[model samples]
Target chain A: MVTLGHFLLFSGLLMAVGLYGVLTRRNLIAVLMSVEILLNAAALAFASAAAFREPHLFAGQIFALFIIVVAAAELSIGFAILLNVYRTHGAVTDDAISEMRG
Target chain B: MSLTAFYALAAFTLVFAVFAVTTANMVRAAFSLAITFFLIAGLYLLLGSPALAAIQFMVNASAIPIMTLFIIMMTRSRSSGAPRTWQIAAGLLAAAAALVFFKGAVGHHDGQINPVSPELLGSNLLQAALLPFEVASVLLLLAMVGAIALARRRSG
Candidate 1:
């Protein structure tokens, strides 16, 4: 009974929430968290599409697995960047670290 | 019953995701994010992708949150002030626009819902996507090195 529309709607809402968070939050870590949410939304969409469209190939699930690994790598690097920024700037707010202002 | 369970899990994931994003407390937000991850994993299981669900549970639910917490501890940067009214308005507008866009873009799919088995996934990975899988591993290794290099204290 749960159709692709249901999954798409859920992921759409989640992606919207993540976009709002990314735009509004000043903290870099929070923005990173929002990015994670967005990635999860993408993964959900892929899985649902695979389930409905090409259920035999399992390509969508494999892609989702790759997405998870990439997200993990991205988080590690992002946290490292946060730590470095905190060490140098003494603050983590996106507005506070504006050294590269053109 | 299955449909009901799916709806419940989806609602739980979305609610906690909102909490993760909107809450000002950093630690609480991280925990909320973890809860969302777990709920999404459950949803994946309900969708008949147990391999993906287990990976989601292990990596997103447990490992990623722990890393985030460690970073939070190291930085000790917990001051999250309220956004300006204009920023909030812009964010809301963007969110609304995104919702409309996605809703219009994704069409309803009426094809057969064939659940992918773990064996199929493994064979596909090993046969069709083997190179990409190895490349992803290499990318992970590079990321590990890059993180270590970036976080290392400079020798004065």
Candidate 2:
């Protein structure tokens, strides 16, 4: 039988991969994709914990739904920012946008 | 039988997630991300939360990947170069750090698994999480307006 440990380990490794992507990818869009992975990892953790531990309560599922909505809003804004970045900077790499770096 | 399916789904999720991160082609990475989402939705179904699985499929698998692809097309940001040595080292360090942090944070679990129904989830949302639910809708509206404003062409 699948246990909570299995889910936790899965999410933990997934989160690690996302962290690796965010740290290494110079492309701004790639970084945003990594952020999405991280968000999904969080959702999985929440859902699994709710499913295994307190299955009667819908709290975990509700929270995961909220997470999905928030992720959508975030992606929309992120894509908008990507468009603006490409327009102004002429490139979408993180190194290309250093106007705010002091 | 179910255990085997769970393991298979878990492996698929991890592999695609790695591909999503490491692939050089941005479009390929986005597609890999979609596959990862789909596999995670399968895991959610296995966990007995079909509502969450459906939401995951609809948003992460469909909407998000399409939006990412559109942005990729608009920006034309293609990086076909391999990662530099320093970047590879940094990625490894970050992954190691994340693993260590997770190992330290999440301890043993002793809770029972009780599958919840969609009806209970709906009532809970309306009664208990009412404010947050309304707030989320308002947030989505604001996000839509903000995206339009941001992506609008300047007529100078």
Candidate 3:
């Protein structure tokens, strides 16, 4: 049986991997990539729960859809910002982009 | 149970995620992220939410990651690598916490779920959440505009 446990485990692993990337990556784009992973993990967990709960678990699915949409939007803006930073600085290092680091 | 198929798909998703995240190349990472998202969309299919699968495919797989890839292309970024050590360590620790939290939330044991789903699964997902959906759409538009604005060079 494809149990809920399996989904949870896989999603958990995905989340961890994403977390590792988000923490470790110096590139703004890479960090954004990690955020994508994290969001997908959340969607997996939610969808699996919905599958087990009731026939009308559309709420969870819809919410996940929303999250994905928002994620796309967030990434677009984030990339733009990164590009801008790159234009001015010629570099997009995570640490170096900070102006408020004082 | 479809244990083999289920395990196979989830494994595919997991492995791709690892490749996507760990790969040093930024463009490769973007591609990996897209693959992971696609496989996760398959997971949504298994979970009886084809609406979610479609949305995942359309948005995450299509519109979003491609945008990232295009941005990378536009920038021609020679840069590679993520943050430094402490940041990576912090992410790992937090991800570990998330795993723990998820495990607890799902309970101690795996439930026997019926993977054979109905045809009209979450078909109305978009209809019901129309308002929030529209708001999200607007946010996406704003984000696109903001990205372009950021990318633009100001004239002297």
Would you list the C-alpha lDDT of every candidate in the order shown? Answer: 0.88, 0.87, 0.74
lDDT of 2 by residue, A1-102 (tens): 677777888889999999988888888899899999999999998888888875554778888898899999998999999899899898888778898898
Write down the TM-score for model 1: 0.96
Between candidates 1 and 2, which one is better according to lDDT? 1
In candidate 1, what are the lDDT values of residues A31-102, reduced to their tens digit? Answer: 999999999999998998888786655778888999999999999999999899998899899777997899
Q: Which has the better lDDT: candidate 1, or candidate 3?
A: 1
Q: Is candidate 1 or candidate 2 better by TM-score?
A: 1
Which has the greatest TM-score? 1
lDDT of 2: 0.87
- Interface residue Cα RMSD of candidate 1 after superposition: 1.6
- By lDDT rank, best first, the candidates go 1, 2, 3
Please give the range of 10 consecutive residues that has the lowest summed lDDT in model 3 chain B.
B114-123
**After TM-score superposition, what is the CA distance of residue B94 in candidate 2 from its true location, in Å?**
1.8
Query: How do these models rank on DockQ, best leading?
Result: 1, 2, 3
Give the range where candidate 2 chain B is weakest over 10 consecutive residues by summed lDDT: B104-113
lDDT of 3 by residue, B1-156 (tens): 567877888888888888877777888778878888888877777776566777788888887777888877877763566456777678778878977877765553555443423344433644666678678778878887887777778998
Clashing pairs in 3: A23-B87, A23-B88, A24-B83, A24-B88, A25-B82, A25-B83, A26-B82, A26-B83
Error of 1 at B95 (Å): 0.9
In order of appearance, the predictions have TM-scores of 0.96, 0.94, 0.86
Each model's DockQ score: 0.71, 0.67, 0.64
Docking class of 1: medium
